[model samples]
Target: MSSSPLASATFWLLLMNTTWPSHVHNTAPTPRGCASRARGSPNSSCPRQRRSATSPDQFVPRKAASYYDLLGVKSDASADEIKNAFFDKSKKLHPDSNPSNPELHSQFVELNEAYRVLSKEPSRKEYDLKIQHSYQGRQAFGSTSGHTVYRSTTTNDNVHYWEQFRHAQSPEATAEERKQKKKRNFRLVIYCVITMVLSVGAHAVFFRKLEEVHNSFMDEKDRAITELYNEAKERARANGFKKQTEILRQKHADFQEKPEF
Candidate 1:
């Protein structure tokens, strides 16, 4: 008694359904431990743990304390006061004195840096300006944002906290100052050139006027001398003619008296 084709196919389907699951179960790989899971795996069902945003292993940069506060001196403290404070602090905080403590050694480095900046006149002024600018910025930001930003008084191991302000006196600022100085010098040169030109022109005009006056005076003097010479010659010629006439008359009278014999 042969079964129909539909019945035979139904029997094979049931057999495969029962046998396939057992074969798959026997051949399946064992589950790995959550600790041994690879990093960045997308299997969210696994009970693997993740680090939080505030994990201690993450690196966060800290702000440094103010130089004046570090040195235990006022912002307006004189050089001698700052020097004396540095010496006093060094006595306690020096790496040699506190060789056992690394924290104190770090503080000593900060102290040296603060003293190096404050001991010099130019560097101290620059640092003061930077501090003042930072203060003003904080005030403005707080007023506008309505948020109080807290500044930390703690020291940072990184020296880049102060190095950031080195950009405040950047080459761009120096170039601008040099440009202003050059502009002033150029204006001074122009003024000097104008003054010299005006003076030379004035001298030329004065000399020309003096030469004209001298020529006119010389012409007048030559005319007066010629007139005087002509008058003297005429008077001398008239006197000579009068004397000749007188001599002729006396000789004629004598001849007339002698001819009567």
Candidate 2:
């Protein structure tokens, strides 16, 4: 059937309306067409969205040393004795002497630092006092901890009961306790000194370690960023960034005309 000219024109107009992008209905401040389209997605961006804080217990690396144990010296050792002990330990633990054990390398450097402090009269005295103070209030955990107040129910006299756990809890009483404490300190110093030495001498020199800590800290921050970006990108892909921006705009916008919910 031959259609009228006006009817044909109306059919073409409807076709054009279906195919073309219409802006007349756009009340958005950003002309919907103007936003830069997501190009080759970078998979990420800097200045990223913020996140909640993590717990302190989870934040730190390894446990810090008990400084007294680090020095591996008797609480009562004389200044000269401390110096000699440090000198002897340092030679044994120095990284040059032991190449196979990386742990030893770290310990070697740590021990050197501890000995360096212990050999000096002022530092040694201060360190000794500090150790004594750390142990003062707390009961010894075991013979190792210098806290030997044990309760035994077996056949034993009161005197025997008193002796079951050597009263080495008091630093002044047991020379053996002092010896153990000193030994522990030596081990600590050895570890610290070796760590320091290895850190310096390591061939690759973990660049991130330059940030006051070992390379691990930088790695942590990077992983955090990666996680954050991945999360955001997923949200962007699923919901579309334009809708997200609109929701945010409506939340913040204070237009006289009520904004569309």
Candidate 3:
């Protein structure tokens, strides 16, 4: 059947109105045509619509584990407790137990590292201190009212704890440090004083030995002079000259008074 021109024009107008974007009717700002087209439809340009565009799983963030939590142990767990817990966890996570699962090997590696730190007394103490600090930090910035407040540490954000936890000072630590410093200073002073005493004693002994050598040289010189004079007097007597012998003796006495080397 042939329709009237007025009816055909009215039908085209209704079709065009139905195809127009929904945001045009609203008072909000309209997005660009290209962005609207790229979004698959102009109705998807609204802020509410944009958020629902992606799946909820895409926004789900991953979280990292603390050493104590990873090992399934309390912060105050003893060395024996830590060891037992580690062996129990490691046996299940070991790669040999799950040969088909490569991921278990990685889990085992992390468990091994956790054990390595917790097994030692010193490292375990440090770890416990770090965990305490982390908990305190979390408490300080915990959620208040309707808002969740988070502290932005310089280290790994996902871990929720410091990777290289800084060593904190306590009363015992301070006293031990002071005691060590004092001991070191005392040892250094003692070493210096001992060195000084030894040096002074060495100098005194050297001078005493030098004085003894000088005295010995003087005694030998005097003895040599007396012997030479006595021999000269005896030679004069053996020649059968009484006056010459007496003169020689007199000369010997004068020479003995002042002899030159």
Candidate 4:
């Protein structure tokens, strides 16, 4: 019923790691009801919905870069064309070739991710379907006339659609993003505290050892000096040099007056 300290630490570490989200850039098809949600209308079979259902492969994300666009190729471009484009872009944006430039490195990563999805057969088909679905969704908001009078322009409709779509998605996405950011900051603070504690502990041990060594050296030096002084006194007494012995005794008595190591 009680966990050990190691178990508790491991639990927290795993929790921290588990809370981190995957950074994969792959996109999935927008749900079928997105258009109705975008328009704030109860009609599930709105014009966009009908059109999307009819041609789901025509979908494309309005806000995202298409694989064809990223690769600088036509939608109908061949696999070889995509490969060539990737090679050219990779050479230009590779991080090793452009050191200390983070922007270029990011671009290269995106490029590689795009290539990874586009280069595979099954993934390419899935990606194409999602792209078509997005394109059709965007088209769902295109200009429509009632009684030969246009209600809204394409640009205005698109603006309104995106506004509603963003409003719906914003709350949940923002909450998750904020939660992740706070978790990352908390992890960083924990790391800093641990580093500081270890550093202080190491310095304390080092200085304590240094002080001990210094005391031992000073004691040895003082004993050697005392022996030399005794030898000098005896030699002076044996030679009958009382004045020299007195001078040596006076100097030895004032040893603390001189500079110490």
Give the best candidate by TM-score.
Answer: 3
Best by lDDT: 1
- Model 2: CA > 4 A from native: 1-72, 140-261
Backbone clashes counted, model 4: 10
Candidate 4 lDDT over 144-253, as tens digits, reads 31112122455754454344333212234446867989999999999999999999999999999999999999999999999999997788877677777687788898
Per-residue lDDT, model 3, residue 27, is 62
What local distance difference test score does each model get?
A: 0.74, 0.60, 0.69, 0.69
Which 10-residue window of candidate 1 scores lowest in summed lDDT? 145-154
The CA-based lDDT of model 3 is what? 0.69
Candidates ranked, most accurate by TM-score first: 3, 1, 4, 2
In terms of lDDT, which candidate is stronger, 1 or 2? 1
User: What lDDT score is found at residue 42 in candidate 3?
Assistant: 50
TM-score result, candidate 2: 0.27
lDDT of 2 by residue, 1-261 (tens): 899999999999898778534665553354343345453446533223345487566575443454335556666677656555655665677567878876665565455555555655797678667667656644445334443232233343344434423432222334576788999999999999999899777844665457557557888999999999999788878878888788668866656457567
lDDT of 2: 0.60
Q: Write the per-residue lDDT of candidate 1 for residues 1-261, one digit (tens) a residue.
A: 999999999999898777456677766444567557776689645644568989977965445568898899999999778878887887788667867887775676677778778877899999889877777887887745332233324454445345434422323444686798899999999999999999999999999999999999999999999999988677667768777567678888887889564
* Predicted structure 1: clash tally: 0
